[model samples]
Target: MEPFTIYEQQMQRKLTRWGIRLQKEPNLLERASKSIQNRINQVIPDKIHTTITATVKGIVQTTLFGITYMPKTDPLRGVSMADRDAKAEELLSLYKKIAAAEGAGTGAGGILLGLADFPILIGIKLKFLFELAHVYGYSTHDYRERLFILYVFQLAFSSAKKKPELLHTIKNWPAISQTFPPAADVMKQVNWLQLQQEYRDTIDFRKMLQLIPGIGAVVGAWANFGLLEELGVAGMNCYRMRNLQDKAAELADK
Candidate 1:
């Protein structure tokens, strides 16, 4: 009956629908495409696969764990969910523009710059996630929190086949994460091969177009902008599910 209660209801419905969508089986076209990709991957040299896996793992680990690159952000303590959501929208708007600009710049430079966009775009996305985590009042200073950020990143960008399991894990992250004690090496838990392959498979088609000399700029900007848009929605909704579900559980206890 109350305004806050109604808002929570809306969020609950949204999260439920999103959960259902995440569980969708990959469609026919997707399966076919994946088959083709897999065939291609099988033919690629093992050394090349190893190199790519190593490169992606290095980039993620460096960006995620490097204290120097960590954004100086603090939790938005004691804020109402509505206020936090509004602030998150503002932050996402800023990041979207930054991504678009970077995409355009690199795309205009042709193949070399386009090739360079992988790490650069990933850096922007990671930075945005750090800021987003703070917006939702979560501190990334803890190992699990950084792991949470990575999970959210994968949720938004990983292959469709991986989505259902990822969604389930994220939904139960508070409990699932605890199985790993503080001393456990977070990096060791990650499936680095899955991480790199799914991420590459997810974005390869559109991102590859950005390497073209002529249309590269336009494609780059569009693709980068869309990436943020998807991530923005996922980030906000994932946080809402966690926050709202926790609050509900607390009320139930009371």
Candidate 2:
């Protein structure tokens, strides 16, 4: 057997384990966390929530509707899923380090950088996810593909209630993507407000600690590193699911 083929088999096995975990119901601990998070959210000032939501909306709108550099996914092909993911991880690692460094610097400044701070991290995550889409051989030029990037993103940072549904959308993305026509406006189907709210609410507390003066730097680096790590896991496995399932379909027809 060829080396590439052997690596692919190993990846497929890992994908199997990832898939099982994806669909498993959230346990009691997760539910309790959600409750606590909700209580915390209720205590947060509405102004902070509004500001975060607006900032996210601005970036997300620009990223989704703005002109893109890549031509299309068809022109970009990888030798194998394993190679693609290897490249993906390389890019993800670089991004994680960059975010950590930025976090450390900003964190040292304390709450003085509070509002300005998170947007930088948010921008980093957005850039990384869009880049990760390219690594998966998807065109950032297509709105639908950008939408898919957000889906992977939400899976990483969203409340547990949203994960299973997002996972389902990812599992069925091939069909869903096919549902969109060249001129179709699918953005209406998505709740933009909800998307931003989920993202902000999820990170609000942890990121708040990143604004502290004394301990802020350490918390910032660790928090930012973990955030990217979470996104990397969610992003890679999401793409892996599509690749493995598509391969299964190919073999089934044979």
TM-scores, all candidates, are 0.93, 0.87
Tens digits of per-residue lDDT, candidate 1, 1-254, equal 12346777888888899889889998899999898878877887989678878888887787556774466867778777888889999999999999999999999999989978888888888888888888888887876777788889999988788888889988998889788755247677789888888887878788989998899999999989999999999999989888886686777777
Stretches of candidate 2 exceeding 4 Å from the true structure: 1-4, 68-75, 181-184, 250-254
Clashing pairs in 2: none
Candidates' C-alpha lDDT? 0.84, 0.77
lDDT of 1 at 112: 87
- For candidate 2, lDDT tens digit of each residue in 10-37? 8778867876786687789877877787
Poorly placed runs, candidate 1 (over 4 Å): 1-4
Residue 40 local lDDT, model 1: 75
TM-score, cand. 2 = 0.87
